[model samples]
Target: MKLKELEQLKNEGVDHISSIERRRFLKLGFLVTGVYLGGKALSLAPLTEAQAAEVVPPKGKYSYSPHYSMVIRERLCINCELCVEACNGTNDVPSYGYRTDILERRRAIVDDKYETIFMPVLCNHCNRPPCVRVCPTTATWKDETTGIVKMNPGRCIGCKTCMTACPYNARYFKEEGRFVDKCNFCYDTLLSKGAKETACVTACPADVRVFGDLADTNSRVYELLHTPETLVWVLRPKTGALPNVYYTNA
Candidate 1:
């Protein structure tokens, strides 16, 4: 039946699901489950023709040398806020602002039993950054060497265009700096000083944050991405940003 017919039935207080409706629902459920499971299995297999086509990078794209990325082992985060404190201190972030923060998600499992997860979020530093595209003054751009999204404070006009364009809500206006500021994976603060990891990564007691070069196959981030029977995902993947930050279970 058409959607209008279904609405009409609902308007007439017809709440019962007929046998035909039940069969249709079951068929759809099976189809969805099969497709999901199939994709999971395919991700673990060696790159075939179809898989290679999907995974391979197109020429002239924003592929970087080090391809700096971070992986959040979400299941291990305990909302301690030590990482946040480390980030604020390292970057001189104000009390009103943050380069990283924690979010809470709660779900009811069964019989009033609930599970809560603390999710830590930061700048994704996308390969195809919407913030970079929207910047009129070219104040923000992705670093060619590290693939980290960087900001030039002097060039910013405080127009807030980049702030609006960012899908992750990662950018914030700094009153003292008189410019938009965001996470650069602590590149200028620590990485340039020869540190191997970001402040947040080093401060996490639970080892929840893994920061490294994604391009290097020997790196932890690369191995985590390649691990079989593991689920890896990026936030707002539908935005087509190709974020460098990834999330997965411990």
Candidate 2:
């Protein structure tokens, strides 16, 4: 069967499963297992050299100048939610909305003992952002200087196309402001004000979040990316966004 067929079957299975079973299955890490099985099903068809080469980027195809990126140290997140508070205060975010948030995943570590992983999520600031592509008024765009995905509230038409386009559920409608809102890595509020880092990064006591320029080789983000034997990944890689935000245990 094709990968799409497998995905259809997965969705069908999800629909048939009871809520409690689904929740229990997810807690036991069955979601990853199902995805792995789907990938294995797809591996039956091997790609040719030309087909594989199409996925590679050409030389000197850099998207942004500074290439601002963030690294999430997943193991360090303590779920204190200090970063969320800092973001709310720094950006004047309302109580009903959020620019960033944490999610919890449980995995069985021992007999009846489950360990929790706190995942912090935000706007990925993709190189080929779907949100930017779907914006009808060109209100949301990826910044050329810093590569951060930005929103122009004045230009927004309240269409919410960008909100639907985001796979990570990053964008939210700010009803009072009458526009879509999202995380821009604090470029306008902090970086433009001569701050070295974002409010969330500064507030993270566990040092879970690292924001820096990816284009600079001397930067800590560069060093982290170059580190050997480390697993670096992004959320929703299948979406083909090429996100700047990376997650790793190291």
Candidate 3:
């Protein structure tokens, strides 16, 4: 309240603030200093992460016809790796690489307790796929009808540009095929043959992987994401990839 105390406080300039820095502030409530440069500037209340990120697209705005997607029931995964096995068998994935993987994390729970969490990871099949954008060869692309990110090995040229651009680290170079490969939701082996689910979905013993057409109102994926009070999230949302893969515990 004193004049001297107010004078000692320094102003934090708005210049050079990165998007990531702004996102951090968006996640919590904070007062922001405002500047007016001949135009109106509004200072609004802080937004929660979900509101700020707009993680889920609005209804009727789906880009693909079928809007193929997968939902991972994160808590249900037990690291059995049956899904991995099935993917390898179905896709003929080499030993040194994987189209899907399971990751483990330990979280602190009630007093002095830790719980192990297993996460199933694969290509997210982003609506704004970085891989597709960076590929000079047009080897990898998102299927317009199904929304699956697919690869044409013949045109790949083994450049690995797509591999670097992928935020999820989902693609890997196949020594035998001499090209980059990633999960395509089993579009080639199963889905293209009129299969309802991907190999991983069928092999998951814990029912962790749920695959369906998100655009269909009657589909389970749409129901899971729209259910009241359920928290649905995607990995690397900060990347602005708009991934189709979602995760939920409910």
Candidate 4:
């Protein structure tokens, strides 16, 4: 139904609603759950177990020719914050904001022993970027050639719509420029200058962050993701953003 027509419909009191109408509403609820909850919550998948490959794009099937991507080695992160410093310095990020940050988690290993895991996170540069979709002024968009979610600072009116749409919480409003800013994978700083790796990747002493073109099979990022027996995953996969950034301990 057209939005205007639906809006014009008289509100049927809940007590007077028909059974078929209730059923339709319930069906839609289930469909939404199945999509955002990966079908497991409602047991929508019955034939076979879901595979890791479901989240990953097929090999050699990258949408962009360069297909810029990153693979975070979860176990190698040490919380040194060098990567964070490099990113802020390279991108000219404000003191109150961060383009990337490290998250800490403690998990039991064996015999009452717990290990601290430091997780470094940044913008995923998703294939279906919600940020681009919600921007009212065409301030942000996903670059077609590099798959980088770029922002036109001058065009941003500080609406923060893209910030709300980002599932990873990657965007922040920049007070200096009076615009929203997020990670662009050092595109303007390094990639545009013929550099292969981002500032964060180069500054990481632990070698935790691997950045490269995923379209190249021989690239480190591709091997880390496609290697046998390695568990590759993304943050907030239920958002269906199809993020380019992957995580693994391989």
List lDDT for all candidates, in order: 0.84, 0.83, 0.87, 0.88
Residue-level lDDT of model 3, residues 1-250, one tens digit each, is: 9755644556467647654566578654333333342123221111122122478777877878799999999999999999999999999999999999999999999999999999899999988788987888889988879889999999999879999999999999998878999999999899889999999999999999999998888999999999999999999998977899999998
Tens digit per residue, CA lDDT, model 4, 157-193: 9989899999999999999999999999999999999
Off by over 4 Å in 2: 1-62
**Comparing candidate 1 with candidate 4, which one achieves the higher lDDT?**
4
Cα TM-score per model = 0.76, 0.76, 0.79, 0.78
Which parts of model 3 are misplaced by more than 4 Å? 1-53
What candidate 1 gets wrong by more than 4 Å, as runs, is 1-62
lDDT of 2 by residue, 165-230 (tens): 999999999998899999999988999999989999999999999999777778887777668888
Positional deviation of residue 159's Cα in model 2 after best superposition, in angstroms: 1.0
User: Which is the winner by lDDT between candidate 1 and candidate 3?
Assistant: 3
Error of 3 at 178 (Å): 1.0
lDDT of 1 by residue, 114-185 (tens): 999999999998777889878888899878688889999999999999989899999999999999999999
TM-score-superior candidate, 1 or 4? 4
Model 2 Cα shift for residue 80 (angstroms): 0.4
Worst 10 residues of 1 by lDDT: 47-56
Clashes counted in candidate 3 amount to 0
